[model samples]
Target: MRKEVFVAEQRVPEDLEYDEFDAGALHVLAVREDGVALGTGRLLYGEAAVGRTGGDPSVGSLGRLAVRKDARGLGVGVELVRGIEAAARGLGLAAVDLHAQTSASGFYERLGYAGYGDEFHEAGIAHRAMRRSL
Candidate 1:
């Protein structure tokens, strides 16, 4: 389902969808009651996640968050973010950061993330930096 959203529906280049960080990151998969992957997200900690926000050692960066189109509005995204936050807290992280697509900033803001920097383009889409303390 993550591949469907991040790779196919969003047209994100395949290489960017998966990277060296996977092996080191803690991934959370949201599956259906029937046992299918409905959505996914990752919590990055330690040195590997440093570059996510220009080397902010105290922050855990949430990345590669994707919910299947069919799963939209099913509360999957909310659960995924909360799961990532739980993982971050387990790792002793003080905060969490993410490059939220501009369209989703409000969604994240309601989840407690605060926009912190100028908007920029990523994968041809507008994005803004957002953060929330764990």
Candidate 2:
């Protein structure tokens, strides 16, 4: 799923797309009735999320959110994000943070995430830090 959206389509280097954090992160996958995946995301907490969340233990970092091109505009991305946030709350996190692609910031903002800090580039795509309290 990520390979299709990030690595292949978005051109995020495969090596940079998958990281050590994946080992312990809570992953979410949205699938159809027949089991075809529509989207995916992950939640990083505790020590694994320190660097991403500015060392905030109470926050969970959300990453790798990707929805299939055909599945987009059908609410898959929103559901995936909500699923990740639910996982964060289940882990007792006070907030969820994510580095959203600048172009997609509006989508996340509509979901109640507020952007903070300056825009930065990751894998050559501009992004901004965003967060929402659980």
Candidate 3:
């Protein structure tokens, strides 16, 4: 599903889409009543999130968030984020961090995340680092 959104849809390179970090990250999924997956996201905490979270073990890094095209305009994305935050709290994290795609930064900001640092590129797309206290 992440490959569908990051690779096929968004044109992010396949090799870059899946990484060593995936194995240690906590994945969250939003599925349909019929068991079809509508969206997905992941949280990286502890040592796994150090690089993204600025070496802050107390902050879980949220990433790989993707909602299917048909699922847009629905609340699946928001729910997935909330679910990730819940997972972070479960792990005793004090905050959640993410490198959000520039296009979707506003959406995250609306959800109470605040951006920091200048924009940067990853996989050919611009992104901004953001965080929210849990």
Candidate 4:
């Protein structure tokens, strides 16, 4: 579902859609009872995550979060985020950070992430940096 949304639908440039960090990052997939992926997210820890979270060693970076368009408003994204946070907690991380599309900052704020940085363009879309302590 994430590939469909982040890559195909959103056209997030294939090169940027995936990277070397994937090998070491923890990936979380949201699926239905029958095993269909509804959404997906990933957590970057240690050195590989520095750039994504502004070099905060105690923080894990959450990225590649995407939900199937059909699954929007069904809470799949919430579960995907919870799963990523759980992964961060398991790794002894103290917080999580993400570059959220500005339009979706409210959604992340509602989930406990606080936006702090000036808005910027990422992949040609307005974005804001947000953080949440575990």
lDDT of each: 0.90, 0.95, 0.95, 0.90
What tens-digit string does per-residue lDDT give for candidate 3 at 13-65? Answer: 99999999898889999999999999999999899898888888899999999
TM-score of each: 0.95, 0.98, 0.98, 0.95
Model 4: CA > 4 A from native? none
The Cα error of candidate 2 at residue 33, in Å, is: 0.5
Question: Tens digit of lDDT per residue, candidate 2, span 32-112?
Answer: 999999999999999999899999999999999999999999999999999999889889999999999999999999999
lDDT of 1 by residue, 1-134 (tens): 66788778888888877899999889999999899888999888879878886798889989889998888999999999999999899888999999999999998999999998799988788999999998
Which portions of model 2 miss their true places by more than 4 Å?
none
- lDDT string, candidate 4, 1-134, tens digits: 65698779987787887889988989898888999888889899999888888887889999989998989999999999999999899999999999999889999999999999699987777989999999
Q: Give the TM-score of candidate 2.
A: 0.98
Superposition TM-score, candidate 3 onto the true structure: 0.98
RMSD each, Å: 1.0, 0.6, 0.5, 1.0
Give residue 16's lDDT in candidate 2 (0 to 100). Answer: 98
What candidate 3 gets wrong by more than 4 Å, as runs, is none
